[model samples]
Target: MPLTADLTSADLNEIRQSALGAADPLGVAADLAHSAEAGRLADPQDAGLALSLAAEIAESRSKFDAAQRYADAAVTAYGDRDDSPAAAARALRARILYRSGRADEANALVEPLRPLLTRYPDAAAYVTAALAVGGRARDAERWLTEAVQAVVAERGVTEPADADDAGVLFFLLQQRHRLRHALGLQHDTHDNLAERLETRLANANSGAAAAPATDLVFWPRAEFDRLAERTDAYGATWDEHRASLEQELVRQTAAGRTGLALLPGSVDALTAQAGIGGDPVSPENRAGYARALATGTARIAWPPERNGACWCGSGLKYKKCCLPRSRG
Candidate 1:
């Protein structure tokens, strides 16, 4: 079958999420590349986006060459049009290079985009992450500072702008915390990010905790204790997963989904993937196993109200779909 073109970004997101959740993502990667080719024959613009997504999927799985190949195809398809998308494709390539231990090449590909940090926070984050991985702390910090400015530059009252700012702030907080923790030096910048993170996380946790059992998957206090992660070491595993979970929620909300979906690449998913044979609800292997559960487990989030989005990722309200009365 020819691949589906004209897929909304939401559809692409579903494709990506399904692929991530699949036990063997290799099959999905192959299918994605094939679809990219078919999409190219049908529609170049859609093909470019599909290829870019394919590249990202491959990169997520550490298939660097596959990512590069798809990213190259995406860049070609996007040619001479909006450079932002193609440049993002290049950023993925640079990320692959950095992960593959080619720091110089990655830096070269990334440096020119410094001025764009205020617009493309992901690019800035990638540059900083590449530098950090390359043992270039000072360089990484430079980009981190730039990324923070990008977030601060975006303060606004508009909904779309606020949404964009939230996304950028999430990225910045994740990177900034890591950088600051490693440096062991408190800075004004860290203080700003920490404050934001604390407020956001507190809100998210409270909402999740106070939400009805029917709305969210709430474990009892004892159940939570049974499976909760604990370590004598100062582990920020929860912090890391929490940030990603929040980011995924934001994305799903943007797609107008009432049931926010978490990515499957969490530590919980990793532990589950490792074939560790232990009952998840049991207290045995409590820390590691629970950490895995916390990171990878799907937490169902009900829409704020019937007027809010549907759980199915469709950009519609609960009143329009998915309600018992509405479904009838």
Candidate 2:
């Protein structure tokens, strides 16, 4: 049969299943590209769909470069023809940039697209892209916060939610957890990003959307389990450390440190002690701290009363929300 004649919904479903089952996404992407170019698919949406599937599979496999190429192809093929597809492409591109350590570039690329995102604010792809850029830019904490609120708002209006779009929520939660950490806020690190992933999976199971049990045949279950364990360990350590510090502070206050006045120069001295003197804690520290923490052994200290606002300008009270082990 001619290639186009052979195309059917069953064939499309088969291709999707294969894209999800294939361990080698680059190979599947190549085949999809060939098929797409040969006009075996119905339209650009089909091509974009195939590319999107390939990109997701590649990402699950940690083949970021190949994922980027596939994402680029998806975007180009979709060509702003469909809002949803365009948003998905943009999200995929931002994700690839983030994975490649080009956070600044990713933020820049997404800034112009922010207005475009407003139209589809509730769409998972748009929300994911917005949060990705906001978190990566290190200056968009407010934007990230608002994005979370937006997700909650959207979920309130829609019952169950869309499972396919659950990735957006997962990404947003990860971004929120990261942002909180970057600003030195106390957060539950027990599950870290995995908590969000599990929540999304539960939502999917609840009929929010149709989410497959795994991204592809190789979903890195072992790696995820290992990471979850590490998350729990770190969370426990931080909690214990924080409790000890609080207890010490209380004892000191009882012994006569009650006034606890932080002088102007104290901020500077503390900054220097933290090895971040002269570096305004705003945009620069947010980005640097996140990177450092990812590699382990990073710490920051700021008097809650002295630091009126979060370094990221989130407008939240520093001590209550962002300061490390702070009681506000």
Candidate 3:
């Protein structure tokens, strides 16, 4: 049966706050599931938060089947809201469907919602990713471009409440980043893969957006080297990792790992996942890394210079073409 009781605004708001603030979503899922059946957390909204959080964590951990179940539960939980949040759950499920090899079903499910894009940045991001997975990458970019423009156009006005999150602001720019790449447009910051991925992880956490880890600093290449070392994933085989690895060779390449791109956790997760445990950049490593990169021997070189020509060979300046799309 559908969850029937309406939650008090206080109850729902508190739930939303806690879900967004959660570091590890597993506990949130357990807690909500426990209370919800007893009518303590009765609203469909509670189910929305619980199932969506579980789905995101499942997707991040690469439990595709589990992710699909969580997403389906989320859509069912929303109980016919046909609004952006309901559509967001379906969009997320569409991604899992596509990845599970049901490309046509996924596309058919989410394509109509493309015209119903929400002002919520995360909703926009989800719909964009779903379209890209459905063999309509070009259409995804067009939808994202329009969705982003729509949000930016009302930045000071009708922006969603979550708009204040740095992650949300960052998401807007990051989607702008992917849209430019998908369309072969140029930009100044197209080459900074580390920042791109880090910002993405920050965005992926279920919240709109961080903590004291601003103290920990890292150079872009350090991030590349760190991620490179995680080749021995518990979940994926070497060949599988290698195939996705190819897309990482360039900053503009946007394939793979879309979940981490909009991570909702605070700077703490960002620090742990992307900042080398929040250790500051070192001069010795920086210089040595630079030399190795200059000689093309570094594990990962800094992206194309900001003032350099477009990576796409468009003869335009990087800043004009793609750099500006990044929040960095």
Candidate 4:
């Protein structure tokens, strides 16, 4: 039976957390299993995830039969997709089998999925955990290495392109670091870099000044120049807006307010704002614009990689093309 007609993944997460917080393992397992049963009709993937969590809770409560049942259901719900979610369910099922004294069954289930780890780096941790649960540490290490190689091939640079890339890289590195430490192996460059990234990401998430971040909308020089030439107001607002925006941003940054929105206006609204005459945009509209930008607006990360392509859609590298005018 479905707990609710419409329960998003977020809702399921909250439910799980609430049960855990209350120290109710039995309740957590029951609720998650029921939710997964209902959730499978709406979102099979999420339902699979929920069932995996339910299996874990059941395992912790020493209900091996129930745990195996949940894991099997999770695997079925996930289907045969070649993605992280499907891999995760299979891994969980393998772990449950191993812990339930079905070692041969566990190995058989997980062996074919080794190739899946190489194809999807994000699935490595799940597979590694399952292997560890089965006391196959060396096998886990080998698969982990393959996943790291995949990450290297996909990323192709020391510096990640964005936060998501950094996150994945960090996690894989962290896992490898811990495993090597346990095996009494010497640290490598990747391990050292993982330590550095740990600090960097920690500071970034905690909003520390040590790791500065900002978001801004960019208008390519050629496009803005054309608009400026179309009207005196456009030209005037261009200069005034540029200088004032930089000043305001600098002031806000100094005040430790990193997240902000300088909502862009349309050509007519820009003209009206500059007093060159069209219907003026109201304060309420401006407030709504800011809210929209905060919630779902897409903006470029300021300061593109020095050797990377410029954010302005120019063919030249950032340093050679538009870095000089980036402040404006």
RMSD of each: 15.8, 16.4, 15.6, 18.1
Candidate 4 C-alpha lDDT tens digits along 1-328: 2354655787667765665555677676777788778654355568887888788778877888999999999888878766787887788899889988899999998898887765655567778888898999888877777777777778774444234557666677778778866775544546545544564466567877532221232234554565555532222444443443444344446556654444343444334444644322332232344344445555554445789975545568867755554355
- Higher-lDDT candidate among 3 and 4? 4
Please provide TM-scores, in order, for all candidate models, with all chains considered together.
0.50, 0.41, 0.43, 0.57
Tens digit of per-residue lDDT, candidate 2, span 1-328: 1234534556656766766665655676666666766667755457776676667778768888877888778777877574765776676677777778877766665665554443454444444544544464344445555665566577663222223555455455555555565665443422233343554557546755422211111102232233334233222443343332333333335434443321111223324434734442332342343333333432222234645763223466755543544341
| lDDT assessment of candidate 3 | 0.51
For candidate 4, what is the TM-score? 0.57
Best by lDDT: 4
Model 4 error, position 149 (Å)? 2.1
In model 4, which regions exceed 4 Å deviation? 1-6, 38-45, 118-122, 157-167, 206-328
Give candidate 2 misplaced runs (Cα > 4 Å): 1-20, 101-105, 115-141, 148-328
- Candidate 1's TM-score reads 0.50
Against the reference, the lDDT scores of all candidates come to 0.54, 0.50, 0.51, 0.63
Q: Rank all candidate structures by their TM-score, best first, as comma-separated numbers.
A: 4, 1, 3, 2
The better-scoring model by TM-score among 2 and 3 is: 3
Checking candidate 4 for backbone clashes, the offending pairs are none
Model 3 alpha-carbon drift over 4 Å, by segment? 1-44, 132-136, 148-174, 178-184, 188-328
| Ten-residue region with minimum lDDT total, candidate 4 | 210-219
Candidate 2 lowest-lDDT run of ten:
211-220
